[model samples]
Target: MKKNKLEVIPLIDDFSQWLAEADKSDNTIKTYRAVLNQFHEWLLSEGMDLNHLKKKDVQQYITYLESQNKSLATVEKAFATISMFARFLKKLDVVQDIKRKQKDKKNQEAPDSLTLDECNHLLAEVKKRRQPS
Candidate 1:
């Protein structure tokens, strides 16, 4: 009888293993997995290999996220997920650390503010709570 050879496993398999061992919340794990799958799909669409990914590739993904009208916080979360995945790959000796570009502030608009009276009332309440008799 001939012995059968096992086929090479995918990077995602390793990622799933690591995610299982990680001490993270269920929501966090789900979000990370979703972001990773998005990255995997983007890689497939672009004919790119996981081991050969570059910072520019990450930038392109960021641009794609922006084009889809994703909020800055959501984009940041996706970037953080990718960064974590990269670290996992590094630990597995699959690839070196690839530095992603800092996000551009062009899409970040200032948040709306409360009225002066509302701010003053909030501050007064805080002061009252902190004051010693």
Candidate 2:
């Protein structure tokens, strides 16, 4: 689909203007525009666009970001940009139900404890270092 078909680019431009008027930094405006552009491309690839945006669509986009191995911070930034855009369009409902995905327990788990042999080696080192104590 042509980028203009969804009219997203214009909205993004307008949104950037709004951000600037609201005293947003140049870097902040650039970041938000880049994120919205990326989201627009994703929507086009999915055979949809912002005009058809829905909560499920936003959720699926989040899933897509995770699938692409994007860092959690990147995904959250994208979500935040989209949310702000939705608010700009007076369509907050499109993303209101979406929630950021945290790393699963398996991903968040601490590193495995030291092995028994390693533990014994550490103890031996400590004992050797103990001078008259």
Candidate 3:
């Protein structure tokens, strides 16, 4: 079947502007643009309009990514990228709340690294460096 073209010229334009104004690093902006472009391609293939996207559509896209054997971390990053796009859309009043599910609480904990003593020592070192001679 011929894929329907989901008009994203305006979105691309707006995203470029937002990206320019954003405080994000160059790598971050590139990742966000890549993720948004992937979503745009999927929408066209599904014959869906950008303005008419639903939460279920996002869920299905996530599932599709999993089926392709993408790593959980990669999938999560894509979700975050898309969430930024959703926020941009909301800012333009093109859509309502389209926030993705939050990361599992179990996964949100910091990895074992610095201990309380280490943290305190690091803070002290920083303060020492800032002290006047």
Candidate 4:
């Protein structure tokens, strides 16, 4: 009998499993999986092997996501998930520190934006309260 083999993408599932076994909540695991799945999709498009990934690759991906108008926090979260996955694979320092854009040079207020998930949850709550049925 022939068996199917999975490469890096399937690792998202493995990492999710690890997170579950580590007692992470379902919501947390779901968020991690979504973030990692996006990264895996990017890797597939780039045709790069996980074993040969470098810090620059991580930076480029972040840049690509940002170019698409993604918020800084989302980019940061992607970096974080990739870094954690790298650590799980024993690939230390594969991700680099992404610098904040200097849009507000006058007074640098640290980023304090809610993630997409939080925004959606808030909207859902607002909708629930609006419907008095």
Candidate 5:
């Protein structure tokens, strides 16, 4: 009997096995698997497949994570998982030149501000604090 093979969307189990063979800790393998599963789901929503992953898709994912207000550490970890998966899929050679970098607040845009009413109330409080007793 022959086992079924999927050309598209590489199996997470296979990747997990590869990671284990590479001496990655069980916790690391589990974390990578979870991250990959999330990426797979995001790809499905975006009408993409892992077999056809591209640099832009990865960037878009990072943007999506940021939009969802995911912590920087979470985003970086996800990127690392994707980078490792790209290396694992060397034959396909997708997601080239995606380098991880230290996140800088100066490079990032300012976060969205509160609504007008909230800002006004905050200003009023600041003004009250400025007054002496």
Candidate 6:
């Protein structure tokens, strides 16, 4: 049978209480709430209700985030918020530990492709620039 989606509304009270008890700043808690709300809305549109949240669902959301071209930092913050919320929901045994892998830096090129000769050439250029005329 298909699982149900997790309901964000029912979690608000306990989530807020947990955040407050943790001594999280008001802005931090507010950020968490915003992230969760966004995920919750996505859940609804994806035919999920909030009761059947799983790690895969979280992965899908991350994938969706990547597809949207959100920066790695943005995605990381979202994952952190989800984890915090999931930790709270876990106390109630309603949600799984929904942590995800950090997003890759899309703009940074991998260094493995550069040959040793290419590296030496680049280093020479840097050294040449460092030497004053």
- Tens-place lDDT per residue, model 1, 57-104, is 777787788788888787888788877877886742322343334567
Candidate 1: stretches off by over 4 Å? 1-9, 91-133
Candidate 6 C-alpha lDDT tens digits along 74-104: 8888778777777776732333554445545
Candidate 2, residue 23: lDDT:
95
TM-score of 6: 0.63
Sort by TM-score, top down from the best = 2, 5, 4, 6, 3, 1
**lDDT by candidate, in order shown:** 0.69, 0.86, 0.71, 0.74, 0.80, 0.74
Model 3, range 87-114, lDDT digits (tens) per residue?
7777323223434344579978899999
Stretches of candidate 3 off by over 4 Å are: 1-6, 91-133
Candidate 6 lDDT (Cα, 0 to 1): 0.74
lDDT for position 42 in model 5:
84
Task: Flag regions of model 6 displaced more than 4 Å.
Answer: 1-7, 91-133
Candidate 5 regions exceeding 4 Å error are 1-10, 91-102, 105-133
**Candidate with more favorable, higher lDDT: 2 or 6:** 2
Q: In TM-score terms, which candidate is top?
A: 2
Return model 2's CA RMSD, one decimal: 5.8
Question: Per-residue alpha-carbon lDDT of model 2 for 8-127, expressed as tens digits?
Answer: 667778899998998999999999998888888888888878766789889999999989999989999999998988887888998887867786779777998999999999999999
Give lDDT: candidate 6, residue 4. 36
Worst 10 residues of 4 by lDDT: 1-10
Q: lDDT per residue, candidate 5, 72-128, as tens digits?
A: 899899988998988887733455655444678687898888999999999999999
Each model's TM-score?
A: 0.59, 0.71, 0.61, 0.65, 0.65, 0.63
lDDT of 1: 0.69
Q: Give candidate 2 regions above 4 Å deviation.
A: 1-6, 103-133
Error of model 5, residue 64, in angstroms: 0.6
Quote the lDDT for 58 in model 5.
90
Error of 1 at 49 (Å): 3.3
Lowest summed lDDT across 10 adjacent residues in model 6 is found at: 91-100
lDDT per residue (tens digit) for residues 13-120 in model 4? 778888888898999888888887777667657766555677777877888988898887888788778887787777767764654343456567677899999999
lDDT score for residue 82 of model 6:
73
Q: Which number leads on lDDT? A: 2
